[model samples]
Target chain A: MRIICCVKHVPDTNAQIQLAANKKDIAREAISYVMSPYDEFAVEEALRIREKNPGTTVAVITLGPERVDQVLRTGLAMGADEAIHILDPDSSITDPLIVARCLAQVIKSGGYDIVFCGRQAVDNDAFQVGSAIATMLNVAGMTLAGKVEVDANAKKVKVERIVEGGTRQIISGSFPVLITAQKGLNEPRFASLPGIMKAKSKPVTKKNAAELGVDLNTKMIIELLEVPVYQRKKRVIQAGEDGKSAVKQLIELLRTEAKVLE
Target chain B: MNILIVAEVSQGKVKRASLEVLTRAREISAGGEIAVALAGAYSADAEKTLARFGAGKVFYTDHDQVSRQNPEAVFELAKMCAAECKAGLILLGASFLGKEVAARLSAQLGAPLANDCIEIKTAGNGVVVQRPMYAGKVIATVQLGGAQNIVSIRPNSCVAKESPAEAQAKKISLDSVSLKTSVESLEIAPLKRPELTEADIVVSGGRGMKGPENYNVIEALADKLGAAVGASRAAVDAGWRPHSDQVGQTGKVVSPKLYIACGISGAVQHFAGMGSSKCIVAINKDAEAPVFKKCDYGIVGDLFQIVPLLTQELSNSRD
Candidate 1:
């Protein structure tokens, strides 16, 4: 069985986010990049599946500039067989649909039985890519999957997905499905020294839009990327001149500022 | 053009979120009639209650197969109803079920959907939706374009509106289609009286709470104030609390009115979830804890000493 996990390099979630000087996007220069939190679960789950059924291959695919090699290496370290990078060095793209179309083209040509991605990229916060990819390929898709079990022989899989205040277990016809994993689905393993060495030797192929029969040209582009306006920081409203005064001030802030009155 | 509000019924009662949707929908659409599509086996009381929310017409599809949770069937019925009514905008709650239904419906209809929107307003370009990203750390204003724009409102984002529009609550029978998946057997969790997501006040513990046994102080304070219980990533990882109760970048994002953090050093990941709370109270022995920077109020004392006294005070005041 062949599985492909689509991963994206995003700013570390732990980074101190500051608005860019131009206020178009978050300050990315000083921040470190890592695989998306949700995709970590996807990659980890893929590794678990391969472990359960030997002879299964898990390939990690990412689209970004050469700097994203670190992200691909991170996946390789996590036990993926190989990595593929779709280099877009300029980082000009902003639309998720175009990205999904390109990925669908590659997935179709690669003959992957299953494809996985994080539910949404933390940076763009667009959840459309995976669903759009599924639509483009005309296959079953599930998002925010908590638990997944594959029956390779039956071409069916059972998924427990989050729904309104609860979870619903649904089964879908498999062997051409897209799924997005949420965090807490699995713990990603650290790469060992030997595995890290092997990752460097593994195949790290590159595919451009032209090679994938996808037009990289875009009509609508982001005129600007700006950091959203941050609300003013909370002032330390000194409560009455006692230990209990602070508690009263806190309650007032909740009622007046936050408006979460209990 | 009519704004079709999708009514969700659970065990024959209208979910409160639907009313909130109608209220928000009422504010956005320009004098458009609010119609509802009730697509499950529902009681008559539900129909009347839905009509109270300014729904001039309620189109219901009741069938045995769709009485429970069935996304495919719900989508089929919704598609038929939406086409028949010529809905310009489709609204659903951004809950677990709503996300699936909205995703399927948007894909089926080939419409651009904005999911988990905290607010919706008409923009010069189109409808602008403000949705919280990175667990409310960032809010994005989105411009959606399609013949029909589908918007899913986040749970607890909007207040329930009470607009007295005396409209007829008519029930229409609809057909049910076969679903690809069926529930074999289901196990339901007992409902906890207080859920962290909907709690007005939340008192959370972290690694500094010391141990699992020390969590009693946090729980006692929450009980006194009728607040929900929350935990930091450290406490959750140490198995001091269920993961569901963890609040941080990796856990549930909540916007309670008041967030009281005890012994939490306020890692950025932990703050991402609860940073949006209106007022924050940090109780830790360390005066330089990171949580202090984000908190509106701080008590540089042992939480063990502070929490019990606060709980007793609240209990006494309530009595």
Candidate 2:
């Protein structure tokens, strides 16, 4: 069995995000990058599948600049057999379709049985790449998957995905499918010292977007970026000079001002 | 230019989010024809409801295979509708279904897409949109470059209004596209409470709630206010609540009218999910909790006392 996990190096969720002088993209400097949180779940799930299927090989792929090699090494430490990094300086400006196309090229050439990716990149917040790749490849795809059950012998997989209104949809699809990881899917394993040391010598292949036949042109242009403005008048209630009376004032306010109550 | 709005129907009624997308489409039509596509099992009542919302033409498809929340089926139908109507702009609500359909359609048609857009407008024979990134910390204004544009409007940002225009209804049945994926079953939790995303008011608890059994206090508050129940990641991780009740970066993003946080310390991840709420009220025992700074109202008190008191007050005032 062969599995491919697509990962991304994004600014840590806790990192402070700043915009470039042009306001078209984020200022990359001074920000720490890590494997996107959901991607950790994807890599962990891939490793678990490899463990279950003795002969399975899991390869992790990333599309980014040279700095992203660090994340690939992290994936290697997490037990992926190899890493493929598609080096594209213009990666930040490209749209999700371009990224999906680049990944489709590699996945098709590798002839992998299944593919995994995080539900969305925390940076762009565009939950499109995995499904776009599936559409481009004409394969089955499931996003926001919370649970996965693979039947390698039957060439099918069952997935329970999170839907709107807190509903779960159990979906089944054939092999050569794509699944996007969601939270609570699985607990990711931590890399041990020995594993980290071993990952230093693992093979990390690099390719350019042009080499993969992916067009560098994008279908959208970012015109401007700005910090979100809050219009609410954050009026903190003065608790009527005491805690007990404050509750009374709050209820009266809710009834008269907010009108949420009564 | 022709514009097509993909309407989502649930339980034989058009979803408010989808209607909001139609409203947005009407506002940006700029003398162009506005059409709406309704897939899945829809009633004539739904079509009439959509028509009243200014749908010039209603394209619909109803079949067992297409009615099971199948993205491929809906994508095919949307693509066909776009092509048939010669639409230059395709709009849908950025709900689960809308995101799936727009993503697939954008890839198959090679169109530019902007997902979860808070604002979209006609820009000189093209379209420009604004969407939040970095978990609602920043907003990006983007210009779609392709001849065809697909956009998913964020829920609760756009309001649906009645225009009461007559619509010409059209039913389309296309050749079946091979579907490699099928929904086997849907296990929906039977909660009489309002859905978190759709609710006007949300009452959320956090680690301070202490235990799973203590959630009853939060539930009581929510029940009194007719609000949905939510929990922070800390509470969910502690197994005090189900994953579905979680509201954070990894959980559901909600923009309710009123958000009352109980015992939550106000982590950035939790704020990212509910930052867009219209009104925020934070109640915590810690006076210096981060939530106090961001909320519209703050009460530094024990949730155990405050919650029940608030619930009792609300219930008493209802009479």
Candidate 3:
């Protein structure tokens, strides 16, 4: 079995984001980058599948500027057999269509049985690329998958999708399918010392948009970016004297001022 | 510049978020027709509700494949409707189903999409929208730069208004599109409380709750206040709660009217999901927890003592 996991390099969730002087883009100088959290789950799931199915090959792929090679290395150290890096600095400003197009081009030629990606990228939060890629490739795709079971012999996969209203939908598709990882899928593993050393020598095949024949034109453009203003008027309820008083005061505020309770 | 709004139905009625999208579409129509596309099972009553919300034209389909909510089939039907209507802009609620359909439609139609938009407006012949980035820390103003644009509006961002108007409802038939995916089964967990995202009030617990058994205190408070139960990532990671109940960047983004945090330290990720709540109340023993600074009300006390007392007080008041 050949499994491919798509990963992305994004600013750490805890990074302090500051707008650049132009105010159109985030300042990148002082920010630390990490593999997107959801993608970690994707990689972990792929590794687990490979472990169960002996002789399965797991490969990681990412599309970004040269800095994204660091993320691919992390995937390699996490036990991926190989890595593919689609290097395009201009990708930073492109839309999901272009990104999906490039990934589709690569995956179409990679001969993978299944594809995995983070449910959404944190930077844009578009949550579209995975499904878009599936559409472009004309493959079955499922988003927000919390659990997956593969019957390789039947050439079928079943997934439980996280839906609204605290409900889940069970979906099944054939091989050559795409799945997006949601939280609670699996816990990712950290690289050991030896794994890190081995990853340094792992082959990373680099390509660009021109070579991949992907159009870089974007249909959406950022006009402005700014920090959002908080509209809430925070009125702290003083403890007054003791815990009992604080509870009483809070209840009063909820009933009267907030009017949330009848 | 005809506008098309995809109306979603849950149970038997139209979703509130879809109604909000219809309302927003009416504002951006610029005197053009505001059309609504309804898929799956719907009723005359649902059509009447859409008409009252200013749907000038209603195009509906009850195709067998679409009833399954297959994104491919749904996208095909929506794309065909948009083509027939010559829709210049398509609007949908940024829901799980909506996002999936919009993404595929954008690719098939070669249209640009802006997802999870909070604000959308008409700029001459084009449309501009604002959406949160970096987990709501920054809002980016995006301009749709194509002949046609597809947008998914975030839930709870816009208010739905009733504007009765002369509307026509037409049922359209679409040819079945063979899809690679199929639904094996759907299991909806019996909900005892409101869904976290749609709940008006939410009571969340964090690691300070100690263990899974200790969550009973949080549940007691939630029961008294008639609020949904939520959990911080720390609590979910500790196996005290399910991921579905998690409220944070990695979890579900909620915008309840009142969000009460119990024993939570208010990590940045957690704040990202609930920052849009109308009112925030933080209850923790640590007076200096980051949540205190952001919350509308802060209480420095042991949750074990404070929560039960608050629940009792609320129950007494109700009686």
List of chain B TM-scores, one per candidate:
0.89, 0.96, 0.94
> lDDT at A113 for candidate 2?
87
- In model 1, pairs of residues that clash are A23-A226, A23-A227, A24-A225, A24-A226, A24-A227, A163-B96, A163-B97, A164-B96, A164-B97
lDDT values for all models: 0.73, 0.85, 0.86
**Worst ten in a row by lDDT for model 1 chain A:** A218-227
Question: Stretches of candidate 3 above 4 Å error?
Answer: A90-92, A231-242, A255-262
Per-residue C-alpha lDDT of model 1 across residues B56-156, encoded as one tens digit per residue: 77777655535655555566667777786788888887655565567667666667677777778876434767776666666666677567877888766
Winner on TM-score (2 vs 3): 2
lDDT of 1 at B312: 66
Supply the TM-score for candidate 3: 0.95
DockQ of every predicted complex: 0.31, 0.64, 0.68
TM-score, candidate 1, first chain: 0.87
The worst-scoring run of ten residues by lDDT in candidate 2 chain A lies at A233-242
Quality class of the docking in candidate 3, CAPRI style: medium
Clashing pairs in 2: none
lDDT string, candidate 2, A63-153, tens digits: 8878889889999998999999998875663688888889888888888888999988887888899889999888899888889999999
Residue pairs that clash (backbone atoms under 3 angstroms), model 3: none
For each candidate, give its TM-score against the true structure. 0.87, 0.96, 0.95
